[model samples]
Target: MSIMALTPPPIPRDGPLLRVDRLRQWFSSGGFMSPRLTVRAVEDVTFEIGRGEILGLVGESGSGKSTLGRAVLRVTDLTDGRVVFDGQDVSTLSKRQLRPLRARMQMIFQDPFASLNPRMTVGQIVGAPLRIQNPGISRSEVEARVGDALRTVGLADSHAERYPHEFSGGQRQRIGIARAFVLAPDFLVADEPVSALDVSIQAQVVNLLMEIKRKLDLTILFISHDLAVVGHVCDRVAVMYLGRIVEIADTRTLFRNPRHPYTEALFSAVPVADPSRRRQRILLKGDLPSPLAPPSGCAFRTRCRYAIPACAEAVPPLAHIGGGHQKACIRDDLALQPAC
Candidate 1:
C-alpha cells in the first residue's frame, strides 16, 4: 500500500492534545555505488502532551531531540509511525491539507538570528503568520494583533518597526516568541528556544514562555539540553538518548530518582548550586555514537555502566517502574539517589 493509504483516521480529542506513536525519521547518506547508510535521527519515539501541559524533551547534542520535535510537528517528513494533533492524524497530511492546521501548530526555532528574516521588520515578522493564515483579515486587525503579540513578549510597539539586527540576543528571541504566539497556536515546539542566549537572559526567556503558556493554555513540547531549565518549566520530562527515550516521568520523580543509566548520568552532570550538596559526576565513556551506524541492541550499551551481556542482544523496551515512571534498561537493580 502507498504511504497515504496507511494514514490513520483522526483520533478523539478527549485524550492528549498531541500523541506521537512509534515515530521514526531517517536520512539517507552516500552515493548509489556506496552502501546506503540511514541516519536514525528518531526511532520508535512515543509520547503524549496533554492540553496546557509542558513536556520537556531533554538530551545531549545529537541525541535527536530536535529531530523528534520537528518530526512531531510534521515540519519534516516521517520515515515511519504516526503523529496525531488535536483531533487530526497529521502524520500523512499533504502541505495543502496541513495549511489550515499550520496556524494551530507553530514552532519557536533554536537560532533567533537565523529563524527570523533580517529583511522583515519586527511587526512584519510577527504579523506574517497572521497574514498568510488569514489572508481575508483586514490589515488594521493584523496590526492590532501584532501590537498585542509584541506587548505579550515584553516588546514595545515602537520596537516593531526595527529590524532583527537592531535587537539584542534576548530581544531577538522575544521577537521570535512574538511571531510564534501571534498565530494563537494551541501546540508549540520550542526547540532550544533559550540555548543561544546569555546565561543571565536564559531565565528571562524561560519565564516569558511559562507566562505565555499559562495565558494561552498552550501545550508545549520543550526541547532542550539543559536539564536545570527543563526541571524548572516542565511538568514532565522525557530523557532521550540515541534517538530513543530511555526514561520518562514527572519532573520531580525523574530528577529525584532517575532509573536508566543514561538518565542517571545526565542528571549527575547537572551542577549543584550548593557546595555542600555536590554530586558525584558520572563521566560516561566515549562520545555519542554516530546515528548513521548506531550500535545494535541498546544504543547506550557501550557507555552504560550497568550494561549486561543481554544489553547487546536486543533493545530493552520501556517498562514502568512506579508512579508513571518508565525506563528502558533491562537491569532492575539500578536507581538514582534522591536529590539533596
Candidate 2:
C-alpha cells in the first residue's frame, strides 16, 4: 500500500455532528470449555456525519449495516470502540446519562409493524420521547408537539388518537417517523426506514423525510440496501461487506466511479430505468460468508474477482484513493466499471 493509502482521512477542524471511532459490536455464543464463537457484527467501523448531512450506509441483508446503525445509536451494548455525538462522548455515558441524550439523538426503526406499540395510541407513542426527556413539559405541550410531528409526516392530528392496529402499513410508518421526529433531533439514525413499506409508499415516505430534513436541517445516518433510494437522498454513501465498510465516497463519485470490487458488484445489480440501456451485472461465485468465521486478510477476497494473492496477506485499511473517496482493497490497477 502507498503512503497515501496508509494515511487517515482528515476530520473537519470544527468537528462533525456524529463521529464513530473504531466502533465494534461483537456477540459471543457457546461458552464454557467448548470455546466461545464471536460474531463480529460491526468491527472497527469509523465514519462521521456533518451537521445537516445525510450519510447513507448500504449493503446486503447480513452485512452488519443495521448492527452498525444500532451501535452508533448505543441501542445495543458495544463490545469496544467509542461513539461521539455532537461533541459528546456518548459511548462512555451511563444508561442514566444516555437517557437525556436520547432527545438529541434518535432512531427511526425499520419495521413499522413491529416498532410501534400495538396497545398505545399514536399520540402516546409519538409523545413518549418528549414526556421522558422533558419531564417539565405540560401534557398540552406534548399533545401539540405530537400533532406537529404527525402533520409534518402527512398525518392528521385525529390519526394520533387511533391505535397502530387501526392504520395501514404506510400510516404506521408515518407514525414511527412522527415519533422519531417529535424531538427534532440533531442526529437521526434511519435504519431502513422505508424498506418495509410498499414501493409507492416508500416514495412518499422518502419525500416526506427529505422535506423534513430541508425544513429542520437535520443530520441523518440513513441505513438501507436500496441503492436507487440512497442515490436520491444521500449526500455521501458508504458500502459495507461482512462487518466492515469496504468503500465510501460522495454520492456522485461512488456511483459513477466506484473503487471497490464489492461496490461494483453490488451496484451492477441495480435495475436501470430505460429499456434501451442494459447494465452488465457483476456476479460473484459464492454467498456472503458467516461473520462467526470470516476469512482472514480481506473477507471479500473469496468472492472478489479482482482479488490477488496479496489480498490474503493482511486486511486492507479503508484508504483514501483521492477526492474524499476511500476503498479497503489494496489493488491499484483494476478499473472497475461504474454503476452509472
Candidate 3:
C-alpha cells in the first residue's frame, strides 16, 4: 500500500495542531574561564504539523533533525522561540504547568534497547507511563490498556511478560511504540525509530507506525536521515541543513521538483531500484561544517554547487517558490531536476 495515500488531509490554515515559530536551540560549550562558545543545534526553524499528518524531518546526522524533534515536544528547553501546541504556548510552561500536557504529547526515542529498561518486563515498561500519568487508575485497567497497546503495535499479551533482552530489535521497538501510545497522545515525536533496526525490519516498523497513526488519528514528527524511508512515509517533508530548514513541501512536489541545492544533493543520494534508470548524483563537497562556527550567511553555501555571491551576503529566508513549496536559497537560475 502507498503510504502517501494513507496520509490525512493538510492542516487547516485557521489553526494548526502544533506551531513552531523561529525556534532556536543553542547549547553552551566551554567553561566560565574559557572562551564561551555556542553550538547552534537548531536555529530559526519553523514549521507546523497538522492533526493526523506525518511531517518528516530529514537531514544529515548532525543537521539537528533529532534536536528539532525534541524541541517541538519540549523534551529539551528551547534557547529562543515559541512552541504552541493545541493552541497553547508550551515554551513558557513550567514543569508543573506542563504536567497535564505531557499526556497529550509523547516521544519514541531512536534506540530501542537503550530506551527500554532491561530491569523491567515489557508490561512494566509499557504501563509505566500510565502509572505516572493516571495514578488513580486501578492495576487491572492499566494492564488491560497495556495489553491493548501491545496488541495495537502487533505484540501479544504474552509478550508483555518478556524482558527487553528477550526480544529482537524490532520487537523491542514495538514495546517502545506501545509505551509511547499508552496515553493515546495526539502528538508523537518518532526520532529515527527504525534507523537501528535490520533492513527487513525497517519496513515492518514503518508500516506499523503508519497503521497506528491512521487508527489513532495521531500527528507525528518522523525524523530520519534516510530519504527513501521519509519519502515513503511522510505527507510533507522539511529538509534541514546545519541548524535551519532549507526546504519544505508536500512529498510529491518536493520529490518531483526540489528547489534548494541541499535538498537536491540529499535527493540524489537515494538509491534507485530500476537498473535502466540512470540518476545523476549531486556530490556535496566538504564535511558538514561545525555548528559552533557555521558560515556567516547560508551554512550550506560552502557546499552548494549553484551557490552565488548573494548566498554569502545574508541568510536566505524560506520564500515561497510555488504550490506551497518553500526554499531558503537566494539563487533562481539553477534547475535541479528530480533524480528519482
**Total residue pair clashes for candidate 1:** 0
RMSD of 3: 6.5
Off by over 4 Å in 1: 1-13, 31-33
Candidate 1, residue 150: the lDDT equals 93
- In model 3, which range of ten residues has the least summed lDDT? 8-17
Show model 3 residue runs off by greater than 4 Å: 1-14
Write down the TM-score for model 3: 0.94
Better of 1 and 3 by lDDT: 3
lDDT: worst 10-residue window of model 1: 331-340
State the lDDT of candidate 2 residue by residue for 170-254, as single tens digits: 8888898888878888888999999999998999999988998888789999999999999999999999999999999999999
Q: State the lDDT of candidate 1 residue by residue for 1-340, as single tens digits.
A: 8988899976645889999999999998886899888899999988889999999999899999999988988888899999999867999999989999999999999899899898999989998999899889898898899999999899898888999999999999999999998988999999999999999999999999999999899999999999889999999999999999999999998888888889888878888888787567889989999998889899999998888899999988988888989889888887565443
Candidate 1 collision pairs: none
